[model samples]
Target: MKKKIVLAYSGGLDTSVLLSWIKETYDAEVIAFCANIGQDDELKGLNAKAKKTGALKIYVDDLQEEFAKDFIFPMMQAGAIYEGQYFLGTSIARPLIAKRMVEIAKAEGATAIGHGATGKGNDQVRFELTTAALAPDLEIIAPWRDERFRTQFPGRAEMIAYCEEKKIPIQASAKKPFSMDRNLLHISYEAGILEDPWFNAGDVKYRDYFTTLSVFPEDAPDKAEYVVLDFDKGNCVAVNSKPMNPLQVMKALNKLGGKHGVGRVDMVENRFVGMKSRGVYETPGGAILHFAHRQIESLTMDREVMHLRDSLIPEYAKLVYNGFWYAPERLALQALVTESQKNVSGTVRVKLYKGGIHAAGRQSQFSLYNPHIATMEADPTKAYNQDDATGFIHLNGLRLRVNSQVNGPANIGG
Candidate 1:
């Protein structure tokens, strides 16, 4: 029996061609696996296409619920926003896809696993590192990095030409000079025309190939939609008081939030490999969850704990965004994030309208909010001490005063 290979296939232009390339080059049986992480209609007819394109069999797993509850909710809890704008939407999905691909490779007794991630992008690192962590023995085949693949197809236009020569059916539309990746979590646009940082998407006369701008929200809906997220040990359990599977809740929120245009991010972020790149993302469900989770934390977490974690949020975000989801430092920080959320078990009410998700109210069995101590207009017997301020300010500013007098008044460096 010939040694077999399993590919992480998407049935897209690149993966479609990769299927044939792998089969011809290795003379091995190619088993393609697709994970349905909320990709919707994109998964339809993928099996047929894979079979026709030369795959012996195609495996498509529905991982939407697992993706939301396991991957996305943790990111939201950790406040894992990349560079404070890009939400690590695409970054989080790669590990899950690659992890499963490795599992399939093991089950099939395949000696190798292949992916369509390009050479010059972050997905290659995200996919390969995950494969390394999960199945180090299995050889990874990245076609874009391969000398033969590069020579045969050096660019997108050449890939398209090969697709046409091979009689692969490709849909034609209004010309779009950019590439987009869409999953259940979000849709990201980059490369080609979008590589230009100053190119206004709205100014362009062409239509987007993979995303629908018509779904964008601006005018407010007539009524506000209120959602309640149930968190247990930092994972969301329910939405809108309904006991739902995690993936189901994400799907529900995606529909609800997409209509209102909740999660859209555009930014220029520094890449892990040391280049700044421009990207636009749509993360409707994720934005709503993060906003609501932070609201509940504000009412539950201790002030000092919250402040300390808030200071480290950027670092935590950086770790996840940089593809260290399984790294030791990230796991250690996750332990801290989870510990702080022990009492974060509760329901948070959020109001969604227009493009923003606002926390309407929050309640927790372990809530630290108290009316007596929190109210500012209360009587003298409140939670804070008024006389303590006299010594507090002087003690805190003692070094500041001495340093200013000694080294030119109010000198910061002193």
Candidate 2:
């Protein structure tokens, strides 16, 4: 019996070539696996394509709800944004995909697994690390890093020729200048023209051809759209007063946000592989959730707790970005993040317009915003006495006063 190897196949040119190469090189039976984490129509006819490319069988798992509830919500609650911009859309999905890959490999009694991730990118690290963490004994076949594989097909022309000779059906006439990774949360575009940091990623030529989730901000409607999101313990439960499941909530938000051009970002980010890459991303639903989450946090979260969590945002974001999702340190950090969400239940009304979302209103039953104490209109006997500030100010500034007296005030016009 031939050894069975599970391949994380995408039915793309690279993976299509890889499927045939794995079979020919190792004399192994290849079982293709595609995780359907809400890529919409991307998975359509994937099984047929895999079989045509010599796959023994194909496994397409619908992971939309799990992606949203397990991965996205936790990251959102942690406020993990890589480099203060990216929502870590691609970063957060890898571990879940690898976890499922491991499960399938075990069930099928496969000793080896393969992925089409390139050696230069972060996906290779994310996939391999998660696999190592979950099932270290299983062999990981990374074709991009394989010397034989590199020698056989050094470029796209060779890859395409190999596919043609093997009778593998490819979807495109020619290789695209750019690359993309799309999931429920976002669509990311990078490489080729985008590799040039000064390139205008949103130029009209690329904008019309590439944009699927959103219009350009300038092309969005003149009027703003209002959306009300309801949260229970930091996870959005409803939109516009209609209760929805995690996937439905995202779909609803995506529709509204897409129309308003709510999420678009272009940045040159530092990859975990020690290289900077410029990419453009559209994260319409995620943008809405981020804005709404902050609005609720402001009302319900304690000030000091928020500050402490804010301080850890960069570290937490780094872990996800660096493929440490399954590491002990990330798990421990996430515990603190989960604890901070106990009272983050509320409704946030958001105003969405061209490329922006503003929290118009927010309220919670467990709100810490006390009106009487915060109000400017004062009663002499209110909880916060105005006279108390005189002593408070003097006490707080005593060090400054003493320093001035001791130094005899430095020269004013030096």
Instruction: Give the clashing pairs for model 1.
Output: 65-247
**Each prediction's whole-model lDDT (CA):** 0.80, 0.90
Cα lDDT of model 2 by residue, 63-121, tens digit:
99999989988998987888978989899999999999899999999998999998999
Model 1's alpha-carbon lDDT is: 0.80
- Which residue segments of model 2 deviate by more than 4 Å? 398-414
lDDT of 1 by residue, 1-414 (tens): 986999988888889889888898999899999999877788889988899888998999988777877788777778777767877878898888888888888888899999888777888888888777778898988888999999998766877777778776555234467777777778888877778888765332433442342244544476778878887756677888788776877777787887776787768889887788988777888788778778888888899989888888999888777677777888899888888878887888888887778888888888898776667776456558778899999999999899888886863484
Pick the TM-score winner. Answer: 2
